[model samples]
Target: MILESFDRRTIANLEAALERVCDGRPDGADHELRSFIADAMVACAKKGQTTLGALTEAGEAALARRGISDRKQA
Candidate 1:
């Protein structure tokens, strides 16, 4: 749950990274980029993480807008 508590700044960084991975390709991202993003998300989900709910929600909404759903398995 701590990952769910990440601060705004941290979430911003993660969002930026996600964006980078998403926008790096001309046609579209490949499997490698997707895996990298998934790994980054997993790393971001570890305990002790602190994220702002508002920021996280904003990021989630953005991802949804882009059709990039969270791949984090429950």
Candidate 2:
């Protein structure tokens, strides 16, 4: 998917948003989760969710739909 060209500030914000849920676990072991997040971001962007908050919410909702929890439970 062709994602929108966001400004540096927006890009930084989105990356930070993704990191909150991904937690720096995008190595080989967490490839699937990484892919899910990437795809979700694309989906959100396609739907005009360019803001960090919107993308984050879309990513979480997408993962939740697939029963994949990004939260860390105590």
Each candidate's root-mean-square deviation in Å? 11.2, 5.6
- Could you estimate the TM-score for every candidate? 0.37, 0.62
Model 2 error, position 28 (Å): 11
Can you write out model 2's per-residue Cα lDDT over 1-74, one digit (the tens) per residue? 24256666656656766776677544423768767776787667666677888888876776676563435441
Which has the greatest TM-score?
2
Model 1: lDDT to the true structure: 0.50
For model 2 the TM-score comes to 0.62
Over the stretch 1-74, how does candidate 1's per-residue lDDT look in tens digits?
43576666676656665565467456246665455554545454454342544334443444454454444431
Question: Which pairs clash in the backbone of model 1?
Answer: 5-50, 5-51, 6-50, 6-51, 6-52, 7-50, 7-51
Clashing residue pairs in candidate 2 (N, C-alpha, C atoms within 3 angstroms): none
Which residues of candidate 2, in runs, are more than 4 Å off?
Answer: 1-10, 24-29, 68-74
Positional deviation of residue 56's Cα in model 2 after best superposition, in angstroms = 0.7
